[model samples]
Each structure stands twice: as structure tokens, then as C-alpha cells.
Target chain A: MAEAEQVKVLRFWASPWSFRVELALKLKGVPHEKVEEDLANKSPLLLASNPIHKKIPVLLHNGKAIPESLIILEYIDETWTDNPILPKAPHERGMARFWSRFIDDKCVGACWMSCWTEGETQQMFMEQARACLRILDDELGGRRFFGGESIGLVDISASFFALWLGVLQEVAGISLINGDEFPNLCRWIEGFVASDVVTECLPPRDKLLAVFQSKKQAILATKSMVY
Target chain B: MAEAEQVKVLRFWASPWSFRVELALKLKGVPHEKVEEDLANKSPLLLASNPIHKKIPVLLHNGKAIPESLIILEYIDETWTDNPILPKAPHERGMARFWSRFIDDKCVGACWMSCWTEGETQQMFMEQARACLRILDDELGGRRFFGGESIGLVDISASFFALWLGVLQEVAGISLINGDEFPNLCRWIEGFVASDVVTECLPPRDKLLAVFQSKKQAILATKSMVY
Candidate 1:
């Protein structure tokens, strides 16, 4: 019999990007070993595997390294035929890619910066973030999830909103995702986190909260020192 | 006989992102109608087609719109399999996507900004742009194309460097792509723009230069008014 194809993931615990890759793997029932990296002092394997960005999560399948979480997700879906993460039709697949990129390009950074910044800057980013959330809520409409019945590409890509954004908002003492303002997205957060595959792999909420809280505290300390 | 599929592209002539979509279609021999958008006053059709971003080029096939250039390119490839722009292997396809994104996320904006900014800011962006060019040159290595013998995803995505960057650099009186510094990249650009499909679709060099020159003049006028 042929040896099982070796699969491994290089990841940091607190990254939502890493979470996306893990979720995709678990969803597909791809049994892979996980290697946690010290991002502050990255390993040689990590560096050699991904020289371009030198960032995780890098997916290694039979010694072939695939970097970038979105790219990794697509690679996994393409390689493993069962439990498809992306839709079948070309147009639907294109839309899936479009929304996934939208969440990354428009939503994530704006929402993230809204937490880290203050005063006018924070307000600017907050508005942008809110606008994005509103658009997302509209897109979700009456669908149970962004992927309809299953948690697929956009849901996986928007995993940051399902977990990290909530934690970061709490740490920063902001409420970007009010149930009233973004009812669909709020409901999505509930459904997405409670899903089995996601629940198994997500970093514990308290741990994520602690990480962001300390980071926020450090940022505040730096601001006080400067001003 | 059944009616032929109605294929259209909402585009602005000078936009490299738009150019990418056009080149892919032409390379695939897919007949398409081009509707040039008045970017200052965008049409309702363009707005309706891509409600999320409202930017071109939007590919309308049988009236189903696909927005974002890279997404459109993928859609085009999947929908029409002839003259494949992406490699057949899953890993190679993933790499193609990675490099295409790298060019967009890292190279284009930095190179464009390097042309427009001045003094310390210009120097900072210039260094970043140069670093990106060096990395791209190294990746090109000895390959006749980034696609290794034909124009493909990375070659198409990096089209900005082939035409627009050269025009912008000349207009700004800066020399970022010296033949010695990025010989492989320079050679790739030469071959890429000289290729039949690319050569046929590219905007006239003199017209592009005139457009950038007027924009630079307007920017200088605004700067002088401020400082």
C-alpha cells in the first residue's frame, strides 16, 4: 500500500488567517499535523517554506509548501475533492472569490484599525467598518450563512468577524457589531462559532481576548509616553 | 440557431486592472464588447453590475456580472478552457494566484506612489518599489516568462510594469527600472508587451504619457497652492 500523503500546517494560535486554513482542513476531514510557530522568532522551516511573505499559515502537503491563507484554502479545496469549500458553478465560484477578497480588503483592515486607533482616526475607520458590516448584512439577507446551508469560502474567509473582531472590540471597549444594527451578521457570528469544525479549532475566546487586551494596553502606554 | 452569449467588459482605458481583463479575453480568443466607463461619471450599468465595489472592469457574460480583474480572469479561464492562462496543476495554480496577488498588493501601489510623491516620502516608496522589483527579477530568474514560456497570470498581473510604469516613470523624471538592476524583469516586460495579444490591446504610449503629464501638472498646481 502507498504511504499516506504527509500533510502539515505551520500556524500561530491567535491568527484568524491561520484559523481559516485549519477550518478548511477540518471541514474536508484532512488529518494533518499542526506545527505551532513562534512568530516573534520564526523558524527556519517557516522562512524557507515561504520566502516571499515569510508569514503563516503555510500548508505543506507531501513537502510542497503553499503560503497565504486564502491561497491555501483554494489549494486544499482543489486538491481534496470531497466536502467542497467553494461552490461548483463558475459564476458562483467567482462571486465566492469576490466576497472573500471583499472581506479581506474592505472589512478586516477597517474594522481592525477602528479598534487600534482613537479620536478622529478611529471614527473614520469606525464609519468605514460599519459601512462594510451593513453591506455584509445586506448580502447575508435571509440566508442562514454566507455559504447558504454550509460554512464555505466567504464564511471561512470572514472567520475573523466570527471570533477575533468580537474579542478585539471588547478589548478596545467598542461595539462595532451591535445585534440591532447588524442582525444578520450577529446571527452569523452565533451560527459560525457554534458550528462543529470551527468550534474544535478556534482559539479559546478568553485567550484571544487576553492577547488583544495586552496589545491594546501596550499601545495605550506608548501613546501616553509620547503625548 | 441559438443566440450567442453576450459578453461585455466595463472598462476605463488607462487602468491596468482593466487592461488585465482585456488581455485575458483576447488571449483566450473570446470575442467581447468593451464599454469604456466615464470614471468621473460612472454609468448606472457599471454601478448595477458591481454594486459592492462599483469599479471596472466588470465582465458581463449572458448578463451575469463578474467584478474585480483577477476574479474575472479566473472566471474567464474556467468558463472558456482554450488557451489556458493558468497552469493545470493545483500547486502551480496556487503559486500563480499567489504571485498575481503579490504584484497587486506589493508592487503596483508602491511603484505608482513612487512616481507621484517627493523628497523623503518619494525616497521611502522608491526603495520599497525597488525591493519589490528585485524580488520579482529573482523570481523571473531565467524563465522566458513568469509562466515559463508563455504569458500567464503573473505576467498579465504585472502588466503595469510593462506599459504604465514606464510611462509614469518617464513623466515623473525617475528611472526605477534600469536595465542593469532588473534585467530579467526588463526582458520579461519587453517580451510581454511585445507579445501579439498584449501589443494589440495596449493603449498608445504617447496618449498615456500625455494623460499622466496633465495629471502631474494638476498635482503640482494643487501642491503649490497649499505650500
Candidate 2:
């Protein structure tokens, strides 16, 4: 009868952003092909699909490309009505969007910069990151997940913290999250990674560590060359 | 009979962020009370309503507060379900959200910083802002508005460019938008502000200029003191 709907994801394997799109598709049970890209030499398709940002992961649905992981996640949820990733009520949906934006605006950048920086700059970022984590911890409260029972928009938006941040901290030789300081967030991370869909989609931990370590070494090499 | 719905907006008159919320509500014909906040001394209601960011433009609907201008726009659209601000199709909605975010994440900071800084830093920011505007101009090619035929999400999200940016550029003695470079955007800005609803809600041009002029003077005063 009708041809199967064409769905594809333009992704880079090591990216948490790309991982978010994969995880969302799996959660929704949407069948899609994956086109891996060499980020250094980005594919024409990737460039064409997302000319504005020129970054992954873009969700290609029947030739229509939707870029930005958070936006893609919303698109996926809207397109496939099953396994709703956002809350049903309008107010709840508003809160979900707000928190997801917060994670992107405040938490991710601060936490990321904290790992990549040094001295007073790093300390400032570390403090900022901690403040963000404290707010998130308070928000998470006693819920099983940020989405409450099942992973939802905020959790998917926050996939970076669930895995990448930890790996990044290790690679950068710093510790931002621990049981003593952020028990709620640590527990949420453990439960989040252990989930079936997330576990399936996440890149292997050691491989991720190796990638970041090498990148860090390269940064050091570049610094020395400049000096 | 049940009491009528109470919709209120905690706002700062000069703030573009607050302006977006008020404009959206006006577009949808949603009646709302404005609770003006003094930036120097924020009210307890404002603080409690938006603890996470503690910023202006919080929407209070029947006592449920929604923070962040973009998020609130979505909420208003969902709850009221009339005079739709976003598009009908999923892909279009995704694009609208994408561009709105791009304006916030890239254009706003660069354009604002270009006005506030000088010398090498100002030049750097000005270039970044122009590059972003060029992309936007190309995207808008021949379309009457970003939403096409009517004001929608992107147009609303880009409210800054329509009014505030022009004023700030004049105050700072820099020219970013003109007939030659950004003809499409210039046209869009003219049409956008000329709209009845936008015209009604916009802060007085003279008042806006005076506020920015004073603020710029304060910044210069501080800089001179530091030097």
C-alpha cells in the first residue's frame, strides 16, 4: 500500500545533543535510520538541513528537517501522539518548557565551562554550576525523575547532565556531583541512565571518556604550541 | 455564578521581555492586569512567582505563574486556543521555535552588547549581530512577516528588533538596520510596529529613548570612575 514514512537523524556519535534525539525516537518507538556525520567535515546533507546553526542532531521526517534537539523532541512528540514526552495540562507543559530552557540557559553552560576552565574562572563557573544544581535538586525534590515516573522533556533536555557531564568532569580531573553534596541529582542520574531507553541509546562510558581525554590533551598541546 | 478568570502580568514598562507577553495577550484578546515592578526593588509577588529566574514578564493565570516570555507565549496560545500565534503544522512550529530561540541565543546578546561596548569589542559584537541579521534577512526574503501575512511566534519573539534595537542604536550612535543592508527586515519592522495592537502596547518612543539614554550615561559614568 503506502510506502513507509521516511525518518532519519543526522547525528555525531559522541555528542550528547545527538544522543538526545536518538533517545527521544526510541522512547516514542519511532522507527528511523541514522546517518552518522564526521563533524570536522560536516556532510552536505547536515549543512543543508540545518544551515542556520550547522549543527546536529536534525530530525528528518519525510524530507522535512527539524534542527535543535529540544525543538526536535517537541516535534517528535507532536507528530507521534503515543508515549507523550510532555505533560498534558497547559500549565504543566509551560513549567516543563521553562525548566528545559533553564537547563540549557543556566546549567549546561556553567557546568560545561567549569570543566573546561582553570583558576578563578573555573572556580566562578564551578560556583555558578553548583547554584544551578542546587536549584535543580530542589526542583527535582523526591520525584523518580524530573518528568515524574517516566523521563520527559526536562530529562531529555538534561541528558547532558545524566551522562556527559560526569564523563567531562572525569576527563577534566574535577568532581562536580557526589552523593554528599547532590544526593537527589546523583540518584536521578543513576535512575535515568539505568532506564531501558536511555541505557540503549547512551554511548559506552569508557569510549566517551577516551574521546574527551584525547580532546583535552589536544587543547594542552595547542596551548603549548602558542606559548 | 463563578467569578471571571483573573489574568495578570508582572512587568517592567521599559522591558521588551514584558512587552512580548502583553502583546500576545492583546493579540489573543485575553484580558490581563499589569502589575508593574520597580527594577531597583522587585516586589515579593514577583519574587515568589518566579523564584527560579526572579525576572520580569511572569504570567499569572488564576494564580498559576508562568515565567520566561517565550514559554509564556506558548502557554497563552495553548490555554486560550484562539488567534494562534504559532503555525498549524508541526514542522512550521519547530522552525518558529528554532528561529525564536536563535534570536534570543545569538542575535539579542550580540546586538545588545554591540551597543553597550566600544572599540575592538564593539566591532566584534557588531559583526556578529550583522551576520545574524543577514541570515534572518535571507530567511525573510519576500515574506511580509516572519509568520507570513500575519504576526506569529517569530515576529513576536523578535519584538526587540522592531522597536527597542532601533532606539538603542540611535542612543549609542550606531546604525545596524537601514534600507540597503536589511531592506526586508526594515520593512518587517515598519509593518510590525504599525500594527494596531503593537502600536497600542509599545512604550512611548520618547520615554524609551530617555530611559536608555540615562542608562547609557550611568554605564559611561561607572566606566570613567573605574578608569
Candidate 3:
């Protein structure tokens, strides 16, 4: 019999990017240990494993370390083989990768920025964030999820929109995805959260909310000092 | 015989991103049509093919468009597997991707920024750029290219370092790579350009230099006005 592969993830609890790797591992049923890190004071293991970026989350599998959430997800998919997160067909896979990149490029920063800015700057980023979500909503288009019926790469890549949307919106005091406006996206979010594997690994929402709430207070304090 | 796959690339003249797709096609012996776009006046085809980003270097294969350079390179590699750009082993491929992304995310912008800034800022970015190149140089070790004897994904991904480095350095009046400083990188550049397929598709360095020279003048003029 073959020995079981040793797997571990160095992650920070509040990070959406870290959440991506966690979800991918759970979805693929790849059992591994999790080493939670404090962003303020990173561990030596994380510093060594991901010396380049020095950021979470880094996946340590069988003595090799893979950093970057998207890269780790791909590694997980390739290693596990079953419960594939990515599409099989080459073109479909390209499309899936495209949207995932699109979300990272277009949406992630703007979503966070919308939460941190004020007045016209806040409105501008909020509108930009909305435009991005609208495009995603359009992509969802009558389907149950981005991957047709199941949560696949793009869906997992954009999981932040589903899980963290409410907390981000509440803390930021900005609403970008009301059901009436982004109906398909809202429907998809419900399906994503309700999915079996997703439920198993999702960080408690209330805890996530508390984390973001404190972040929001920090942002407010910093802005007050600036003004 | 089955019908030949119709491959067309929509590209701007001087984009390193476009060069990536071109090199991939050539390396794989995939014959394709090139549609050069006036970036100032983007063609409808470019816009239609890549509606979201409206960026150049969109690869149209059998009427289906795939945007983003890295993604297109992967598509080209997958479709035409004779000259494999990515490694066969999944772990090696993951490392290849991680470095490619590291270049895009960390190096490219800093390389360009080093050129356009002056005084402490330029020095800072130059150091950053050198630090990145040093890491890459260390990766190369004594190998002829990033992928060993022959050029592969990491080598192709860092194609900008080979061709654009001189032009960018000349235009910006900055020197990031030299014989003593990045010996392995310097050695790799000589090998990369000498490769037949790369030489065939490489844009004329003189013309590229002229373009950046004019752009630098414009930047200087704008800065003078602001000050």
C-alpha cells in the first residue's frame, strides 16, 4: 500500500485568498493539517515555504511547497483528479481560467477599495465593483452556478462574492449585489453556500463578520487621522 | 485529412504580451494569421473578440477567441503538444506557473517603473528590479535557459527580459542586467535570441527603441509641465 501524502496549508483566518485554498482542499476531499498564521507576526515555516511573496496561503504537500491561491488550487486539482474543480475540455478550461483571472484582476481590489474609501472615491470604486459584479452576474446567466450545476474553478475563485459579500457590504456600508439587481449571482451564491463540501469548510460567517468589522474600524481610524 | 485549425492573433506591434503568443505559435510550428492593431485606434475585431478587457493579444482559434497572454500560451501548448512549453510532471508545471506569475506580478511593472522614474524612486525600483532578476538568475544557475538546454514556459514567459530589456533600458537610461551582475541571465539572453523560432518572430529592436524613445520624451514633457 502507498503511504498517504502529507499535506498542510499555512493560512491567515480572515483572508479570502487563504479561504480559496481551503475550499479547494475540502472540495477535493484532500485531508490535510492547517497552520493558522498571524499576519502581524508570520511564522518561520510560512516565511521559509513562501519566501518570495511571504504571503498566505502556501500549500505544503509531500515536502514541496506551492504558493499563490490559484496555483495551489491547480495543484490540488491535478493531484486529486477526482471532484475536478476545473473543466475538462481545453476551451472550457481556458474560459474558466479567463474568468478566474478576470475576477482577480478586475474585481478583488475594487471590492476591497470600495470598502476603504469615502465620498466620490468610494462611490467611484463602488460603481466599478458593481460593474464587475454585473459582468459576473451576466456570465452566471440562468445557470445554477458558474460551472453549470456544480461549483467549479470560477465559482470557487469568486467565492468571496458569495461568502464575504454581506460582511464586506455591511462593514463598508455599500451594497453592490441586491437580489433584484444581480439575480443570477444571488441565486448562485445561495447554491454555493448550501453545497455540501462548501458548508463543511466555510469559516464561521459571524467570526468572519467580526474580523471585517474590526478592519473597518481600523480603516475609519486611519482615515480620521489623515483628515 | 481533417481541416486545419484556423488560428489568428490580434496584437499590437510592441506588446511583450503579444510576443508571448507569437513565440508559442512559432515554437509549436502552428501556422496562423497576424492582425496588427493600432492601439490608439483598436480594431473592431480586437474589441469584439475581447470585449471585457478590450486588450490586445487575443488569440482567435477556429472563431473562438482566447484573451490574456499566459492563458493563450497554455492553450497553444495544449492544442499543439509537439514542442511542449509546460513540463509534463504536475509539480514542475506548478513551479513554472508560479514563476511566470511572479514575473508578471512583481517584475514587469518594476522593470518599467525603474525606467520612467528618476533619483531615489528610480534607484529604488532599479534595486527591486535587480533583486527580481537576481532571483531569476539564481533560478537559471548555470543552465542555458530557464527550462535548461532549450527554452520552455519560464523562458518564454520571461521573453521580455531577453528582447525588451535593451530597448527599455536604453530608452529609460537604466541598466538592470550586465555581465557581472546577472551573469546567468546575460548568458540566457544570448541563447534565447539565437534560437531560430524566437528570432523569426522578434520585433525589430531598432523600431521598438524608437517607439519607447518617443514615449520617454512625452513623459519628460508631461513631468516638466506638472512641475
Candidate 4:
């Protein structure tokens, strides 16, 4: 008898959270099937796996379902120790968690809002995004990546900055960063996108743009109706 | 020459987050001094330790500071090893993080709102609170604690319900749960509060009542001005 097939990921193409787990698995050389979820009409498997949130990027490992991107990242790191995501030192691990969480809590939603709303609301979110970018740029501190020499947990956690934010900004007609404004982040994003694993797993830019373009139109239409 | 002491916590007395770290340290028996910060006028140490969030419950270990309660709990569990907060199993640890993040993201602020709001707003928040409590009750499912037979990370993460939620409900004159509605949660709270280490560190209910009462009054006053 052979060992059981171990891993599977339920994901949506355009979700950064979903992409986080996908990238982690790819980087770790974990062989797993990707089940693309239709967010508009969620699959039974996705719902059953994550009944609490009914959200995707749920990693099914050895018959257990693990949700939340950061938690999944930790699970992958712990389960497969080779090519570690988090640093071995407790303090460094703590800092990595701090920045990763900071991105999730502060930057991600604000980045979304920056791309969706209009007038004062959009401006406010843009400012929030710019402020977050400034902080992250400073945190990068001339390093090649958030984890210093190479991409690690913090870098993966902030991967949305490289792909999603740029696409969303273009689609929403908002400009939060420029090469001059966030030079360190600009350099980091270039290196992150250039990485083989990341480039392989990232959704194509054109497809991402098409999805967000439609989403933005829907948001603006809804806003107009409310006004 | 003597080696310097290792652990210190920058905390504010009334903060649930600060209480979380305190409880974890006490349970782990990691001896440390507590420096209470004035939240109104945050100290330079607090600001320096957690420059990004600038919030309390910053745990300083041998000159390195780890902010965020859940992160600090992980750090404590990793460093101390004895009286482990999280389970050793990968899947169990993943579930612990899932529920912990769920409570942090969903329950805490909504629980606060359920207490402070009035009329329909209060009613809506109370419904949200009840829904969360229901999920938590089902999750508890006859276990003595969220971590099962012993107090663990999930149990500690939810320690708020034992102390603060009861206080807040009393202060706001709203009842989200009765014994009949959420038997597991009621039992869990009683057990949690009665535990030796929890009882030892928990702030006196009367003092907690005083603080929340004033805070509730302020909220109502602000609402009046807006209206």
C-alpha cells in the first residue's frame, strides 16, 4: 500500500489570499491539486471545508481542512520543513508575523477600497494605501526582500503589492505609488515578480485587469444608484 | 557579572489584549515585571516598542519586543515549552489559530458595539453577537475549554468572554446570552473565571465595571452630540 494523497487547495483566480497559499505550496515543492472556486456560486467542497467563513484558499491536508492564508502558510511551513517560510529565530519569526499581519489588517482592504470608491472616500483610502506603502518601504530598508536575502513569509504575505495592487490601481484610475515615491517597494516588487516560483503561479495581468475592470464598474454603478 | 533579566511586558490595565499576555505569562510561569502605560499619553517605551501599532501588550524578551497578543502567545509557547499554550499537533495548532483569528476579527469589536449602541443598532449588534456565540457554542461541544480538557491558546484567546463581555453587558443593559441559549459558553466562562491562574490575574469586576460604565456614558454623550 502507498501513502495517501495528501494536499489540495480550493482557490479563486483573483484572490490574493488564495494566491498566498498557492505560492507557498509551489515554493515548498508540495504536489497538490488546485480546485478553482466560483466565488459568485461557491462549491460544496469549499463551503464544507470552511463552514465558518465560507471563504476559499482552504488547504485540505490529509483529510483536514485549514483556512486563513496566514494560518495555511504556517501549516505549510510546519508540515513541510524544507524551504522554510518563517525564520528559525523566535524574534525574527515574531517580526515576520507582525509585518505580515500589518499588511493583512491595514494594507489589503485599504488597497481594495482605494480601487473601488470615488471622490472623498477613494481619496481617503488612497492616502491610507500610500501611508502603508511608505511604512512598508521603510521596513524593507534597502533589503532585496521583506525577509532580507530571499523571499519568505513576510514577502509572500505582502505579495499582493506586486500584482493585485498594481492591477487594481490601473483599473480604478487611482495612483498610490510611483518609482520615486516608493523606490524600495518598487525594487522589491520587481525582484518578487522576477522570482521563478512567483512568476509561475501569479494570475496573468490581462485576466486580472479584466476581472477588476468589471468589478469596478459594478461598484460605481451601485454607488450611483445609492446617491 | 550578572546576566540581565529576560522578560518584561508593557501593558495597560483595562486592555483585554494586555490581559491576554499577562495570563499567558502567568500560566507559563515566565517571571516578568509589568510596566503599566498610560494609554491616553503613551510612554516613549510603548511607542518605541510598538512603533507601527503603538498599542500595549508589547512583550519584551531580552531587549526584543513582540507586539500583538496572538503573536506574543505563539512566541511564549515557542520559547517557554512548559505548560504549552498550543497543541503540538500541526492540525490542532492550525484549528487553534483559525478560531483565535476568528474571535479577534469577528467577535471583539462587535461585542463592544453590542454593549454601547442603543435601539436598533444595539439590537443588530446583539444579533451578531448571538450568532458568533452560537458558532462558538457548537465549537465548544461539551469540551471543558476551547482547547478541550485543559486551558490552551484558544481558551486564552477567548478569555475576554469570562471577564469583559459580562461586564460590558451589565454596563450596557443588553443580554446577548442566557444559560438556556448558550449553555456551553456559560459553563466555559464560569470554568475559565474560576481557574486558579485566571482568577489570580483577572481585574476585580467592580473596577472593570467602573471603567466600562464611564466609557459607556461617554459613548452615549457622543451619540447625543451627533444626533
Highest DockQ: which candidate? Answer: 2
Clashes of each: 0, 0, 0, 0
Give all candidates' CA lDDT scores. 0.90, 0.90, 0.86, 0.87
The sequence of per-residue lDDT tens digits that candidate 2 reaches over residues A118-203 is 89998999999999999998899899999999999999998988888898888888999887888899999999999999998899
Query: For each candidate, what is chain B's TM-score?
Result: 0.95, 0.95, 0.94, 0.94
Model 3 chain A worst lDDT window (10 residues): A218-227
Candidate 2 clashes between residue pairs 3 or more apart in a chain or in different chains: none
Listed for every candidate in order, the interface RMSD values in angstroms are: 0.4, 0.4, 0.8, 0.6
Stretches of model 3 off by over 4 angstroms after superposition: A219-227, B219-227
DockQ ranking from best candidate downward:
2, 1, 4, 3
lDDT of 2: 0.90
In the order shown, what is each candidate's alpha-carbon RMSD? 3.3, 3.2, 3.3, 3.1
Q: Which ten residues in a row have the lowest lDDT in candidate 3 chain B?
A: B218-227
The residue pairs found clashing in candidate 4 are none
Candidate 2 segments exceeding 4 Å error: A219-227, B220-227
- Each model's TM-score? 0.96, 0.96, 0.95, 0.96
